[model samples]
Target: MTRIRLLTVAWLVLFPLAGLADYLEVRRETAVYKEPSKKSEKLVTVDPAERSPYLLKLASGAKTKGYYQVNLPGANEKGWIYQSYVRRYKGQHPGYVAYKRTFYKHWIDEDGDCQDTRQEVLIRDADAKVAYQDEDHCKVEASAWKDPYTGKTFTNPKDLDVDHVVPLKNAHESGAWTWSAERKKQYANYLQYEKHLLAVSASENRKKADKGPDRYMPPNAAYHCEYVRIWTKIKRDWELEMTEAEGEKVQQILENCN
Candidate 1:
């Protein structure tokens, strides 16, 4: 009877239709995330930019290499609530905001959500058919706001190319070459909907091409730290490789982030 039962288990292990049954051995030993446990392996450190609490503060307790074990707050209940909702919100900002009489609110609602805000910005731009600021600070570009690199301002998006502080080609050379098309697209379009995509002068952005943030970003005292944070977030999310200089610059920026 024992031998017959062992054979049955072996069959399930090798059968494709058995699906994850082959993983039973691991499943039996490892804990599942959904199952609550008083004992949780702690994660030593999580990237602050992507982590919750927007406090961006490190936990005062012990550190481990396991899951964070904390539930993040919902979009509407957190810091910069309107900022978060900008991703999908629809409809237009009042005409005055569009015309620059009032600054374009980064997120439509003040709740910190981003989804609806993205939809709203895009749709409104489509409806108005007016040109936004250009890289040269000339009228005619849309989506061009601040140029952190030069600490200059631009309104025309047409004269700008949303820069990759770390170039996409560099990403491909690193490990992104192994990623699926969907993930590649996500990494490629990293700044498509965020404030990261700045409208800078054509000559300046071209000069930056695939150069690391340290080499190309602006020297303006005020914007330098934020630039590093943005660059680090992109590379960390995409799991891209960094040169020594790039890493060093990121460290410097992190200091200011605190």
Candidate 2:
């Protein structure tokens, strides 16, 4: 009877503490900062090669501007650092690699239409000022080529939407859930440059809503080459995962890109 009572008491005490630990981990893990320094004034910035109290790596870089940066929330005990340093640090540390381009680049804009499409949608969406709601003027869509899931092509901007090759949910499920809001936004707005986004059929876009890259690719066997490249780039750049089938498909496509 006494042992039973003691176990019950221990459970009560430990349960809340366990819950508290979980809450703290989730809170700390998910919160992303606008700029790394803004969130924690005491946070330190370091070189990728320098041995520090934290485990950090160079995640990405911006060569156009001379700023370097590194990734935080790393696996080791040196502790967390700022996000702004991801790129510069990466350049300094040759071993610290990051993503450079996507397979979408290969999908040539024969008409050089990506920039124009993006600008038009941006302007229209900005003018309306709401996203994903009925009031919004722009939509998220796939490419103009006929979607294999459903044969349709969209020429009209109003009829198309931008689709993330790797779904945002998949990204969130991957380590992205731990990223700052700014990083999430950056990832969401990725490929703002050129044919990275497409003006595709709206119904097809809906069918692919937040689904992973493998879920809805062009069915035409010929298009798979470009399709796999885009998928691989997105997953690798964002550090997302793939089901075995998806990974194999990507491998097959990458052979072609190489």
Candidate 3:
């Protein structure tokens, strides 16, 4: 049996095979974006080394500016991967590693109860019972959270972001790009490990976006040692690659810790 790798927009423009094929396959490492452009929020990357090539499906027959809407491999929602990255899977289609992953699973609703990972994190990190936005309790309206990165205490959920301690892009550069989509998702939303995701002020999180320890550190100097510890532990635990500079910086921070 032959696999139809992709039902890309270009293919549809030529063949127009609507509903004939549903699944999409990846040729190499590529990102599935939240929108049909490169600048949009990245959702995840599909890599050939991690799993089967059939990593996506046509979510709909939608097309826009050379992008095709596709269902993420391990998720229910749709994301966009560029048309050039996809091809009709006649058999043995080859592609280069045009993109390295900087995306990961967002706050997912693992139990499908409407509350997502973000809500769960907010609730857990809150010092008290969280207030809900609505009667259904689907959203957290208010919560007391201390932003370790900025040393500011916040009571509004909108003011905080559940930051990835090891930013997804940094993780990708640290060798997470080689992982399977499922593995990447697991790393992204992992909660078992302490401080993997921290509720920090949105401003600080933005300031720290995708930067490693060498480039970015918490503004709250008091949290510096703990920050380095968590960073190093995550790098060590995940077996992620580290630059010599990063290692040196981490060591410097650790030496000053009590």
Candidate 1 lDDT (Cα, 0 to 1)? 0.38
Candidate 1, RMSD to the unseen true structure: 19.2
Q: Which candidate, 1 or 2, has the higher lDDT?
A: 2
Where's the lowest-lDDT run of ten residues in candidate 3?
A: 10-19
Q: Give the per-residue lDDT of model 1 (tens digit) for 130-193.
A: 4534343223435434556676655554544555565666555433443444555455444353
Q: Return the candidate ranking by TM-score, descending.
A: 3, 1, 2
lDDT of 2 by residue, 1-258 (tens): 000001111100011110111111111112222233344332333322211111223333332233223322321111232333332221122222233234122223233544334444433333233333233334333223334334454434466555555656655543354444455556665555333355445666777776654466655566666666666555544434344455554555667764
lDDT of 2 at 195: 33
All candidates: TM-score: 0.44, 0.42, 0.62
Q: Write the residue-wise lDDT of candidate 3 on 1-258 in tens digits.
A: 112233232101111121124445666678878889999987776666554443345666567988888754323356888877776443222421223444576778888878888887888889867899999899999878888888889998999998889888877655455466777878877878859888889988999988888899999999999998888777756645555567678878888999
Candidate 3 TM-score, true structure as reference: 0.62
Candidate 1 lDDT trough over 10 residues, lowest sum: 1-10
Better of 2 and 3 by lDDT: 3
Off by over 4 Å in 2: 1-153, 192-195, 252-258
